[model samples]
Target: MGTMTPAQRRALYESARFARETTYNGPLGPEYTPAGTRLRLWAPTAEQAAVNLYRKGHDSPCIGTLPLQRGPQGVWSIWLPGDQHGHYYTFTVTVDGVARETGDPYARAGGLNGLRSMIVDLARTAPAGWERDVRPVIPPARRSVWEVSVRDFSQDAASGVRPAWRGKFLAFTQTGTTLHGDGIHPTCLNYLKRLGVGYVQLMPIFDFGSVDEAKPLLRQYNWGYDPTNYNFPEGSYSTDPARGEVRVRECKEMIAALHAAGIGVIMDVVYNHMYRYENVLNNTVPDYFFRQNEDGSLSNGSGCGNEFASERPMARKYMIDSLLYWAQEYHIDGFRFDLMGLYDVDTMNAARAALDALPGGRDILMYGEPWQGGGSQLHRYEANKANLAMLNERIGIFCDDTRDAIKGGCFNAREPGYVEGKPGSFWDVGGAVAAWCRSDRLPPHAPSQIVSYVSAHDNFTLWDKLLCVRYERPEFTASDPVALAQNRLAAGICLTSFGLPFLQAGEEFARTKKGVGNSYHSSPALNRLDWARAGQYHALVDYYRGLLALRAAFPRLGTTDRHAPEALQFFSLEQPLVGWALPAAPGDGAWWRALCVFYNPTDTSRVVPLPAGQWKLLSNGTSSSLWRGESRTYERKALLMPYSATVFGAV
Candidate 1:
């Protein structure tokens, strides 16, 4: 049959069910062949679209302007014979009868700051052994995520990374990098390897709009939540942002290096909104790419201006394609969606399904923030966390309940949690901990559905939160003893909890952001990971390492299944104190049969009742020790220190 007429395409584009169609939506950006360079764009509302080709730089005058033919499904296409790679191009489209120019949204590589799309040979972007790069196999429940930003990771002079490699993707590739202090301590990749974290969730590495790629000395800082291009890597993280190939190659090298160290890389993606509403997609297609109100104003659910219309056919296709592109081309192990709730459930599930279809995709991790910053016209049930029941079982959501309960309140830093020694806080903390560890409270179908953590890149660090608590409550001192104990207790609850555990980059070392909760735009001095803290608080690091070791030794703590009749039993649910026992699964190795965890958030000591058996102390508030004939017979009672957590094993 002949191609559909423009009128027919318009009808389909405006139809309510158009987004559900599975037909070929548009071209996958510019494709170069021996015959010619074929360009295709999705601009349904545009009266005309033309390719404005530049010789080399974006500022250079257009060498040629070729008009494209409007094809079926509102797609525009053109083919220029002998138009080879290495040239730059942008689309000049007539939207609402006014001409507007923009870079290709699907460009794999682009000019500095993503001002122009570059025609690149995709094969040249790959690093050596790129095809053989494989993600480490880490079960979701066993996953311990360490969140880091590429720039903040090694931005400080104390980072000990090579001068040139500091704050760059190559920093992860550097071997033997060490932090200088009382004694040399492993930093960067070495530190992560020694910490035994299975995954490193890097802050948005995509081509974000905030940083000026051309100037390395501008001291620009951003968390990369403002996405300008979804497919390409951030140029600022590369040694040379002027060359598109450098960013791509360096990012791949970083991922390969991380994988070599047995650590998977999870890319933090912001598909909820674009850097600007007047971006490429909107300029080329009017309001088709964004959710619109009845008055035609763009939706501000993302709070960054506009919310992407992921339910639309082309928008959904673009998101799914970008995720798969990252997974397949860049070898990204997983994706952490930013403001995932703004997108529709279908889009999230479709992306998950697409990732699972790829090689090693089953092991691919997927998780995101379940809530949006603002209200949208979209149904609340469409949000990821709101609709978690319908989402893919492999997908996970950040547990804000457990996070707030453990780290006081997110908005109010002074609010006390279990670790903060807040009275009656144990009720909420106990509920959240139980929901996290026992699969019954939140009732997740699979263990991977819950990502439990007290602190992340967004909120106040655990140390900072405790400091705020100390200030509000005179009883809670900010001394090293108090901070160290609370930090250890928080880590114990998180690492020993059931769901996939996630920790902020410097959390292990009690890293602080100087009480600045939102340090997204803060100076490097405030944001950079303090390596010295690792030495000053070496005991805290050891406590974290011990917790991870304990979790590794006892696999029952990470069980995905809901608790059985005898699998998990709570000793008491009283305020300021809570205790529970988790029995080892039948097939688990004989390290210990049952593990008992006790929490005493009160200033005074509390007596916790244990099950009828001889138990060995595996860990207490100050330090943790492996079981080596150190047995303590408890006649159904164990004394716990004030504001401390203890782990016991039934031997």
Candidate 2:
């Protein structure tokens, strides 16, 4: 690399944007800090750039200023005094005229809606009293994930403290010690330990538009997808939103706590679009950041007001820098991309590279929801699929197969109940499973690339789905407690299945959101976790715990090796029931595990024959019935119970 013309530099930026290196968090190695305070920004078009610090309660508030020298490509940087750590600063770019963007590229804090950004001293207040002395250490590869929202996670009734930990950038960034905060309650962590989960996938915590902006009937529900600043965490979740200082510190504390507990935190990031109202895009070069439609309006590809113009080098750099800041500062374990399909393949590849170069580069996990193009329309994101295959070769995907299989075609659909001798809901999952089973098509990095789940935040509760298809017919409601047992059975399938098991915050005891399908806007009543339900669904919860322990005991269950489709046999002779088996490997001397998954959906007792070998029941709709197999099942009439799913094993 040598010094070149401005045109060549522009081309370099454009070309690098397409290269594999761009997919990663940029400058993965070594901190370039040479002095007390440093400033950096990823601005390409500016001829001159300077840092301006502004403080509260002042007429002429800009206290300190420093000019930045442009480095290679578009990076402009300057070093500051060590004492200037907690300052609020923003960048002023002068190309043809003065234009202010958000915050400094290397700004540790302060970016809230492009008004002002924070200058943080990680040394002074890092959790565990860390002195931020160590060099840059990137993140590690993400293994398992646990999705959680802070608002409904816990309640400190006595102290009158709620989940003060809103999704924030700082919560995932700090390192070297355990974070101390009420947010890291025993309930959430204990659940993580029980599930063998490694990562906590947090929803959006950026300083986004008010909740009122996302009301369902308002024809505008941003879901925090419309990012105002790449750096600021959402302030609404914090206790003191006006200052934003408490939010920053508390978030970092939360991250430190999770890290101390040996659990990783991953933020749900949105880079596809910016806010439609009161944004820098509307103030500055509007077309510079947004994708424009034929009528010169913002394109609505992300279902938000606009989509980012990743085709441009500057915009691409902004996203890369934002993500890198999160990884380096927050120490996040992984990222769950929402609607990643909207971004181009090359751009995503660049992002992957940037992340891959970090300290834990190779280990950092990156996953995404591969949705794309147009409002109310789904596009086949080749980028998303390619990224899934390419990334899973490194990371993994939130597999929709188990979810779709247990439910119907979509995540929101409910199961058609446990009908014997009939095709159950998600039968098509067999095809998806069969596809993954094909070794030739599997990603090369890991044996298991899919993160399987029976329920997620996007759909109705597993319990609600059960009641709809099992207990009620014409009108579906969860008030009837008759179908409660069926709900437990579904949870069993989630825990015992092959892929990673993700339990939505409160599904352990079968929580339902009334009849609301997409309740993103419902009151806390819709989202709150009912601790009492844990007791009611204790049997199911215990059953899940046993299954989790069983899976841990047997690595074979989690094995990614898939059986040959034809060799994978399904027996229909057992009428009113379905039997599937994977014969023992040719040379392997292990006892073959014959699976006879029987479902009696109706209220009738249907008799079915048992499989060969010393028959034992692996599970039979109840926790106590799990793990303990009945040895005497060598009988003629197998009594099938209503809304029951039984797994029989051949010893």
Residue 527 displacement in candidate 1 (angstroms) = 0.6
Q: Report the number of clashing residue pairs per model.
A: 0, 43
* Candidate 1 lDDT (Cα, 0 to 1): 0.79
> What lDDT tens digits, residue by residue, belong to model 2 across residues 612-639?
6555566665542455443444433355
For residues 249-275, could you state the per-residue lDDT of candidate 1 as single tens digits? 899999999999988999999988999
How does residue 309 of candidate 2 score in lDDT?
67
Candidate lDDT scores, in order, read 0.79, 0.53
Query: What is the lDDT, from 0 to 100, of the residue 28 in candidate 2?
Result: 16
CA displacement after TM-score superposition, residue 126 of candidate 2 (Å): 1.7
